[model samples]
Target: MKKANVAINKDLCKKCAICVHFCPKEVFTIDQDGYPLISRLDKCTGCRLCFLRCPDFALEVETELDD
Candidate 1:
């Protein structure tokens, strides 16, 4: 929980709700400008669904630590 698994690429993000809808954990929400906002990082099970579902590759999640 110390590190944020879901990283939003502001430049790559077109404010699309793809990541939002794709997340089963309800971890994402639409911002004022319709950008994908990671509302619940704690709820994230490190599921890569949001990352893979994102057509723009705007979101990424890391469940495990790197060796």
Candidate 2:
């Protein structure tokens, strides 16, 4: 198993749903304001889909091996 962490920069993010849509694990959801939120941090596989798909470069995903 692995542990993953996700970070989103609200400032850089233009409220685009790319990260939300790109995430395979459905780790993100949209807030009322349409901003991205971490819905399932534990479910993240650290595939970097959100990070890579983010045009604004607002998303960061890090993974660590579970010991």
* Candidate 2: tens digits of C-alpha lDDT, residues 1-67: 8788999998999997988887888988999999999988888888888888899989888899987
The backbone clash count of each candidate, in order, is 0, 0
lDDT of 1 by residue, 1-67 (tens): 3344778989998876877887888988888888887788888877688888888877777677544
Each prediction's whole-model lDDT (CA): 0.78, 0.88
Clashing residue pairs in candidate 1 (N, C-alpha, C atoms within 3 angstroms): none
Q: Which residue pairs in model 2 clash with each other?
A: none
Off by over 4 Å in 2: none
TM-scores, each model vs. reference: 0.80, 0.92
